[model samples]
Target: MSDEDGAGAGEQLSDDQKQEIAVWFLSNAPAGEIHYVAKDVRALLRDEAVYEAAAAEAYPEYNKAHLVSLELPDRSGDIIITTYGELDKNNYLDPRTAQVATVDHVKQTCTKLRPAADEELPSAYIEEFRNAIDMELSKYVGEAYPKGVCAVYCTSGKDIEEPGADFGLAVVISAARRSPQNFCNGSWRSVWTLEFSYAFQLVEIKGKIQVDAHYFEEGNVQLDTDIDRKDSTLLQTPEDTAVSVTNIIRHQETEYFSSLEESYLNLSDATFKDLRRKLPVTRTLFPWHNTVAFTLTRDLANELGIGK
Candidate 1:
């Protein structure tokens, strides 16, 4: 049941009395948040359950303001690519447009179901898949060097401990490029080499997967010319070896609510009527993308039927 219709503190404050106080308080006072301290207020006006409902009705603008205050930011990323995964509905944004404004509500659930038994591939097929990747990458490496280097790694959400669900695949493609440098008054040509790294990520959602590919320029790295070639081996030094690195794509995880009890307050009709007679009417306009707060004084609280 809503807090408004719920039972109040004991037989001292009946539902009718609380409702009457809430209605009166709302009508009398200017539209704003009203706070009453139990110790400072009278017994009749001490309960706030009735006040909150009345305030919501009398001051809809205030409630809307409170709701908007909980909004969170949208998710963004690099070039996205998906193969088996889809992004039609299940994505970073929630399906319900109305609840989008709610802070606790998420846009999409990144839960992936297990593939059907028939859809599963054999171990040999999986190994072949890995080999196929190596073959495709080898085609891009310069013919001068056959030892083309590439790295593949996996990353997952904080909650994922094993290779179960919500896993991402990252591939770093490092290719060699050669350019000639003029030295000794343009008489000598120095061959300088660069290692271009291209990175991409595959993230699985409910029915489909989402892929984000990094820009070529952002992942490129220039390496030392290292061109003392003996046979097919381009030697820089014994200590110099190409290293493969994986770029991790970061995203916000879903936030869960905790089960805990807490006390909150609002204003009632009778209290509002009393407030109208006692407190001065204050007015303020709300903005589109901001939060506003105010403090009601003791004298105002007392006059509004808050206490003696």
Candidate 2:
């Protein structure tokens, strides 16, 4: 097909054709040339149909795919070549094919499903709880870290079952921070990372809430020093300096983590209602009857085609 016609019609090329285009582009395209690739290698540099077909063959999982150059956040003149896939209705990539879960994925997977009256908490609830924990721990973007490298994640689950409790909630909260310091005449760069993981099950007993909590925390410090010994001070070698600095920072970070854990524990035990009130986006609570009524009204409107 003519390039213009193919472009206008949005033609779906066959796999073999796409493969041919991809092979041709790879043979002619130079490495690390992001501008050429970003400007639609298929349409700008070669036949549109040929270029698109090749992309499809290479990235079969994406319905529509294209090459893009993404610059590193460090502004180090480094660029990564990756495919930008077509977004779904929710403006998110499909989680089944994506390596990382988006915020929408967390919301959908972690939000507790309403349970049937008097039924045991669903097995799915445990999976959701586990997923939420994993999601929170895995995040590496937040204000606390350099350039938003680490994130704080929190998720909640309701209707947890416990003896002598009317209702229960499962809460997971995690945070991480990295602080970097330059010392010894700018010869050494030290990065200190502190991480906190806290999980709690809050159950209401005798009209008062109680919490059972567990936590795991750690702090890491690493030093990147100049390879040359010229910058070393006469009093202490780089190795000795590193050891002393690491020890002091590690001790301080441990105390910091302990303090944070104690504060959160107190909040969970003494001010749980206040904590719970801050979690959800909306404070307004709707009755089950109101939801049922809204659903029925929507169904009736659809049947009558009133909006249409």
Candidate 3:
């Protein structure tokens, strides 16, 4: 790649393709994720330089310092949201509720790596690193994976390590499917390969906790039949769907979050019994974590007259 401002270094790539390349580079580059990140940052700064030059020529009032440079906080983290699934207009499930199952996850955390000195700007560095990535993407402007990046700028970090306090400087990812025709090509065909970026934050925790439960329209018999039939129509169900779901909850309760059982002890016998009566399927409630997840059978839901 030529070093002439690094604006036009390589062949223009689609936004998705660029992200794929970036992921591969971060995971497998010879120097590793950190090294590749630094290199990308330098390249992005070069692109910024090129932009400034062009803008300066066109508008005499253009200021280089005022350019859209990255402003990062001392303790900052990066979040990446990846979502899949076509917009099924026929389905009536709440998008937000369904999205709870497929929310994006934080692929990396840079908080611990930040410089300890008070004068250092670790967040700024991280933001610059992220900006460099955005700069590397092609200059496309349409919805089909159009190139763009956004960051939350902060000035401070969480210093106290209080118990039960979530990471002060952290990144979280959330994702949801959109309409099938959300990103149609010139031929009006939905482009499944396309992706987009979104970000948000939650400020407070109320008295209530959100729960996630997947309701199967088909009863256990139908679920088993579908699994056995291996019908392509049941795209969401695998042959081991029942087994996998059961094992997942079992594993989380028995091995991963064993402390949850202690938290369960605090609930009154009536509440506990009522919970089991309502959700008799493979389920687990982690009171300490404020999470209750369930995998329900259609028959049980019907018995409760849930969707009648």
Candidate 4:
């Protein structure tokens, strides 16, 4: 009933509208047949003709009294019907609006860093760095990727000895997007997933901080039935008798990944430079250095077995 249900988008349907659709389906859709087997009567009669005559006489009454339900078939047609039926029932939202909102939500709330519990580095300094990185990444949200969802997670080492050297930090970023594209008279949903793992190192030279980073990126995309399928036979191959959703997903995964690889490459390059620039920088020790000196001193004392 809420926006969070069913793909996290789409308008809520009124009770009247929902009831109307249900009634239409029950009245017009295919209804399963109900057959009554009079086994005991047939055994007692011991006459095929008598049993048949009795069955024929009682058939109309039984049919009128029993309930017949509409059930979807257990094949590809069911999939296509259910998918589009739900969308129409809920008054599905526009794909473009859903895509943009999803990306914005990810940008605002998905960047996170979790340092080890035993880390000896000053928490304040670590938090400052994380905030800085998150801020830098925010600028690329709607720019580098016009539509998609992205999340970033960073983990740091337990012991960081140097202020501006490699500290065993690792960052992983995950991104995805959904698109509904028209095919013939119907539509298909294309979903993409991209993951990037970065080996991160920091360097400071002449009061300026820089990032020395290398990352490995991989991506996958899949397509699923979204709307009407006029000719189900079109989805099947000459050698096959039925449509295989698994094969369709796998084949699209490979094809779309290759086609979209260039866009992801551009995003990666732009992000690397953004990290290097460390934009909105202040003179020496970043903008959060006002109290970092004291915190660093305390950390050093604790490391030397002199302070708690």
Q: What is the TM-score of each candidate against the true structure?
A: 0.17, 0.22, 0.16, 0.22
- Candidate 4 all-Cα RMSD: 31.2
Worst 10-residue lDDT window for candidate 4 reads: 205-214
Q: For candidate 3, lDDT tens digit of each residue in 58-134?
A: 22111111111111223232222211111121111111112111111121221222222332222443333223322
Instruction: In model 4, state the lDDT of residue 48.
Output: 63
User: Over the stretch 9-78, how does candidate 4's per-residue lDDT look in tens digits?
Assistant: 5665554444443333323211111121255445645666655554544432332121111111221110
Q: Name the regions of candidate 3 deviating beyond 4 angstroms.
A: 1-126, 129-168, 177-211, 214-308
Give the winner by lDDT.
2
Off by over 4 Å in 1: 1-14, 27-32, 35-44, 48-99, 103-308
What lDDT does candidate 2 reach at residue 177?
20
lDDT for model 1 comes to 0.24
Ranking by TM-score: 2, 4, 1, 3
Query: Cα miss at 188, model 2 (Å)?
Result: 23
* Model 1 worst lDDT run, 10 consecutive residues: 252-261
Could you give candidate 2's per-residue lDDT for residues 1-308 as a string of tens digits? Answer: 57766544577766565556555554333222222443465555356655555544433221111112222223322111111212232122211112221112211121111222222222343334334432443232121222212111112233433222222222211121211221100011112221211222221111111111111123321211111110111112223433333344334433443443455445433443443333256665433332222232233223222223
